[model samples]
Target: MNPTELLSLLALKKAPLVGDILAKKLIREFGSASAVFEQDKPSIAALEGMGDKKASFIENKTFLFKKAEKELEFIEKHRIKYRVYYNDDYSKRLQYCPDGPIIYFEKGKIELDNPYVLSIVGTRQITTNAAAFLEKFISEIAPLNPIIVSGYAYGVDILAHKLAIENKLQTVAVLAHGLNQTYPRNHEAYNEQMMENGGFISDFWHSDSFDRKNFLGRNRIIAGLSEATVVIESASKGGSLVTADLASDYNREVFAVPGRVNDKYSIGCNELIKQAKAHMLTKTEDIAYILGWEKKQDIAIQKQLFVELNDEEKQVFKYLKKADKELLDIIAMDLQMPVHKVASMLMGMELKGVVKPLPGKLFTLA
Candidate 1:
């Protein structure tokens, strides 16, 4: 984009109450951010959801442009890279989100063209079990070469980035603050290594404040950038759950690792699975299967050669083989098994590469 248009977009983003959705709408209606700035008050107010007050705010661009100009200077001085929402280089998945930022800055060598981008999030106080699971999960899924995304915070987020680097996979850290500085101070150690392969991303400008509320905005970017979000562990309340909710709102697939009901960090994940908001993630294959990444031919080979199902799982396999696709309830009833028992068997069978889940609680042989 030209410097003139870029300045207008930055100023528009700084405008009070214009926000991402309305800013995008204004740009769409006016053909460009510069055009929106050139429009008269009457024309601006005439747009849907716009009023005299908002039009006035948008028209009063003097202060906004001053801030934008300062930010532009900072961008040039730091050699920071950025992506505009309408550009081809911006994240394709994030573009689908209505609230996605119109412009986001990046640092280091960041490439997001990978077909499979996965966001993994959890509590700051990650448990041993969750850590072990993430280590093994990243190693197993490394062969697929997905770009790993996470908040560059404590616990799960930082660990996810480290593991991705160790596995030689691209990993991007979505920050709550600006790319000019790292949060938590201690994590600055890994920044150099992370930027070598992955990098840092933030919508917050160099001048933006580092505040608690910024995390919500940061979480949206995390959720928006990926085809799926995985919650490895979370308490009943946390920022990771917020990311999961945003992912769901964007109509992206969500997965939660099942854990003992009484475990503190497992409560949120259990609730998500019980409420049917996310799939029950038992193993690495579950993600591949649910996202349709596992080819039928590949699964067929695994099923024929590697799978060794127990009696109950074998029963589910036989039933699904004949039924083609069957509901969970019907499978339990027809097989004279309890619903819970059948569900458990199906989960185990799915991990074994003999069964796959369909929409509306249906299952079929893989």
Candidate 2:
């Protein structure tokens, strides 16, 4: 069979060991996927990590081709969009990651070039506080137009996606299952709305199913795909703490919204901050500030927020507030007692929803 028919057939049959690792190994050792197809017995056997069990699995080109034909037939018949690694438009970032998908299936329009991309993750069973915190937290960050990426799973993942779309922001769902079907089944309508706004992506083909291991694979994609990762809530296991781990490994900023110490779901986030793997934050401002965007803050806003501030926070806010303020001057100046008294009042006012903590410590007359 020709190469076109051969690949399709392999895909349709759900050929054993045809996953990304095997495909990468084949390309690395043989120098080309087509070369592996024509390989002599020893050359094929010499492929690292490919023992006889895997070697024997691909001998059938015609039969597998027939099955692959059916799979492609299924996708086209059902209208699923497919993207192969060799394709020009494959995710530019994933192509470099060792753990990236073998193939990606995109169902609708997907745009990942947003100015800011964030991923907020956590456990399946979340807290009332975590849920409430996320609602308030997202509302504050919504106007910024962030492209949020998450697993589209039960807890924080779905919550992030739901809030992003509900607020009219672009939201992408990185999936664990194949594009041929949406897993957890309950998210069908939400999934549809996302495609219209943010869209979804999966590394597997139609033959792939949502296995136990696929979720971690999903997590890495989420981490690598986003500019920053925020862990709203997590347990000792599962959810987005693992994604935070991946984000750090990938050299991206990691953040966690702190929850009460006693909560199990929040334990991972707290541990991450304790270990310095992530920064602690309550709102998206923490991320924007760390990313060096505070430089662009309005000066009038900066003056009110920074001029009367005291101590370390004052210094930091002052440095951030003005275009030029020596750190030494900040260290030397004594804070005003009235400012402290005003600060306490302001904190209360802000918490009461009467005012906001604007950039540069500027508080409007809310």
Candidate 3:
């Protein structure tokens, strides 16, 4: 955390092939990043995965340290804030990821302690349907006050941030480049507003090139920072799907909205669902239910009064009110609805606080 220790971390991060995983291992073994630099070549090479060749790169500490010092100057000059992986303020979910960045920089009033953090991503080329879905989804989920995480690219990513801001929720934008500059330039307009509530996060240095491959690293951060990652829409091959895979790899929940079979952007999401890689996201409740998010006790009673139910939900609500508590199957039969449809309605209603699920698959008016 001190200047010297931070310089060592920046230098270690700059070492070629001495990535986050290996850097963390060395830090753990030596007790600190500064200590790692004090070791002789033999001592460094003796560690697992470090051979003579890799040790040689680490031995050239002078060059690495000079680069790090320049970065340190940049940090100081710009007043950018950073977090080491082991720091208490670092993201807890991200800490669980083996390959998470050793240090990431930020610029804004960002808060990661919020209990509900979600990473929502999708195709850069957004579709009307996907946009509509995100708008409604964020609005419905706003009361829970989740921190929305997304890449600050065009289309779905930017839209998600805008919606989060509109809903008065904190939204963090994970950048592929550095905080020194915004990638698309056009998105610069949102920077001030974003920082006012949330802010930008990146592991890339100011000197790092804005290469296409950097997105893989950025996607991992997005995935690691949240309890769940939702793919709003994606083409057959895109970054959002990659984030979903990374989230799943981290043992975090992944939700993908199903789209029309023939739609181009829907292919990736559909494949994710078909392969059982992601949950089929139909309604907002699916996220709340799967994540086991409970409503605040103070608002539980009032939520029902304000929730607007559709005709189908109205029917389910009326039945639950009359029956008090009944089995899912009985409710489906009594309402002349398919069991699946009724179950779906129950999940949505449960989210709205209009209904509550009881033991043995029973449902009742809340």
Best by TM-score: 3
Q: For model 3, state the Cα shift of residue 190 in Å.
A: 0.6
The C-alpha RMSD of each candidate to the native structure, in angstroms, is 12.7, 11.1, 10.4
Model 3 spans > 4 angstroms off: 295-306, 309-366
Candidate scoring better on lDDT of 2 and 3: 3
lDDT of prediction 1: 0.88
Give all TM-scores, in the order shown. 0.81, 0.72, 0.83
Clashes of each: 0, 7, 0
Candidate 3: C-alpha lDDT: 0.90
Q: What ordering of candidates by lDDT runs from best to worst?
A: 3, 1, 2
Per residue, candidate 3 scores C-alpha lDDT tens digits across 1-366 of 688899999999989878899999999999999999999989989999888887786668999999999999999999999999999999899999999999999999999999999999999899998999999898778757789999999999999999999867899999998889888889999999999889999999999867889999999999999999999999999899899999999999999999999999999999999999999999887887788775433466346534888978867765665567999999999889999999998998898888888889988877
Q: Which ten residues in a row are the worst by lDDT in model 2?
A: 322-331
TM-score of 1: 0.81
lDDT scores in order: 0.88, 0.68, 0.90
